[model samples]
Target: MSLRAVSMGAAYHTAGRVPGPFYRLAPVVAWTVWNLNPAWRRRLTRTMLPLCEGDRARARRAARRALQHVLEYYLDLVTLPRRDMSRFERDHLEIFHNERLDLLRSNGPVLLVSAHTGNAEMAIQALTFRGRSFVALVERLEPRDWAEYMLRLRSSAGGTFLEANFAGVRSCIEALRRGGVVGVMGDRDIQHTGVCTSFFGRRVRLPRGPWELARRTGATVIPIFSSRKRGDQFRVYVEEPFVVEESEDAERDIRAAVERYVVLLERHLRRDPGQWAVLEDFWKVHACGEG
Candidate 1:
């Protein structure tokens, strides 16, 4: 087993045996570290400054809270399997615009596009509780064991996982053709072949795969967002789905479709600026160095 697997295994077993109050301390420690760590502070400030409307102080505060929330999110994941499902539903999860989900259920196929903000993993997991199953495309993390461990956590609620790769893309397309739902991240360009678009009054490149896939498969593109309300409680937003408009210029059409999501993503980020968890220099032209 890898080091990460070992650590996660230890945490899982410990959290399972210990009381819930003890698990709560993990976020406290994470928050302190997030504030003290220089590298994390710099990255957070750089990514959040503009998002906070150029307010340096507000950006710094949001950065600290963003890290704290992200850490809390992961801690919740490790202990999720041990929590009571009924209690979780009654006390933790809240769904807004659920009729949109009903629409998705009645529709054929869908491409669920979400950002790095909030507990996105949990959003996908929420579908399982509602008796909906979907395939999520995720980037493989470092240390094979850690990746496997995360994949296990993500699928524990009943969804499927597909690594972000060529084969995974093919599998996603096939699944969509068969009227299956596929969840993908829309905020960052993992493959570096993204299309440039305006976000928060700045230019950033977003992944084109989701839009391209939607166009090819005639899938409805829906924007989903998850926000941590307090402690382990969360609010999930499922927006209406829109079909990508096709035009003679395929590339332009794809860029336009991506721009639409960019607008939606920016709106969500503005609403909950602290929950936006992207750590990269998203607006920098050469951030990816993928020439």
Candidate 2:
């Protein structure tokens, strides 16, 4: 069991933002098999939420069903050919297809804050199909082969990948000023100076880059996501722009803004825990005083 678990972990960790659809689809295929089988799904469900109340077996069953529903859509993403993805866009138009229409249709820059809850790749694809102006911030992939492949894939989605570093910020700011949107995910703390906030009822580090950039640029802060829905479709949720509240204590005010973002992230994750793909001790470093 330990070997099998470690092997899966290694595989996922090594596949950092692989751009090709095949590379991304491989794991989804494995996950779908794991999810389709009732017994296996129930076992994983129980292991994931052992702390939940009620009869362990019954609780696991309900959670298993919910996960199955989520996985069904993930499977569709892999199995179905997305040819003329334009058609799929129209079918789900109600799901925020028009929320950023003006910004995308125009030449001005915008900031999009996303989290790691569902298949974010689909959201990026949707933006590209609609001629959205945006660049996505992500950690640079190591190894020459991997980096080259990922950049190609990301470019197909209309995103210019800015490596996570000081220089990347300059590029991101440029994109915003050029009437393009900059996309960043805030759920995980990749920066040493990230603001600490509560998540899942416990304090953890949250990235402050988006809020800081928004304040500096006077650009809109939009929270956008594409979560899996029934029947292999996606529900694109777009919250109104977030304004950074000013205060005498700027540092404290920044932390406060981050806390609010964390709260919304927690609520969304709680609504669909299976959508979260985290497997490590997410709060471990914080709890140990290392963060």
Reference-based lDDT, each prediction:
0.78, 0.60
lDDT of candidate 1 over 197-282, digit per residue (tens): 66776666789999999999998888888888866778888877898878888899899888888777778887878888666655
The collision pairs in model 2 are: 107-179, 108-179, 109-179, 109-180
TM-score versus the correct structure, for each prediction: 0.90, 0.70
**Model 1 residue pairs with clashes:** none
Cα RMSDs, all models: 2.6, 6.9
What shift in Å separates residue 79 of candidate 1 from its native position after superposition? Answer: 2.7
Q: Per-residue CA lDDT of candidate 2, range 152-246, in tens?
A: 54554345776778888888887777667788887767766787765655556778888887766766777776566544456777766666766
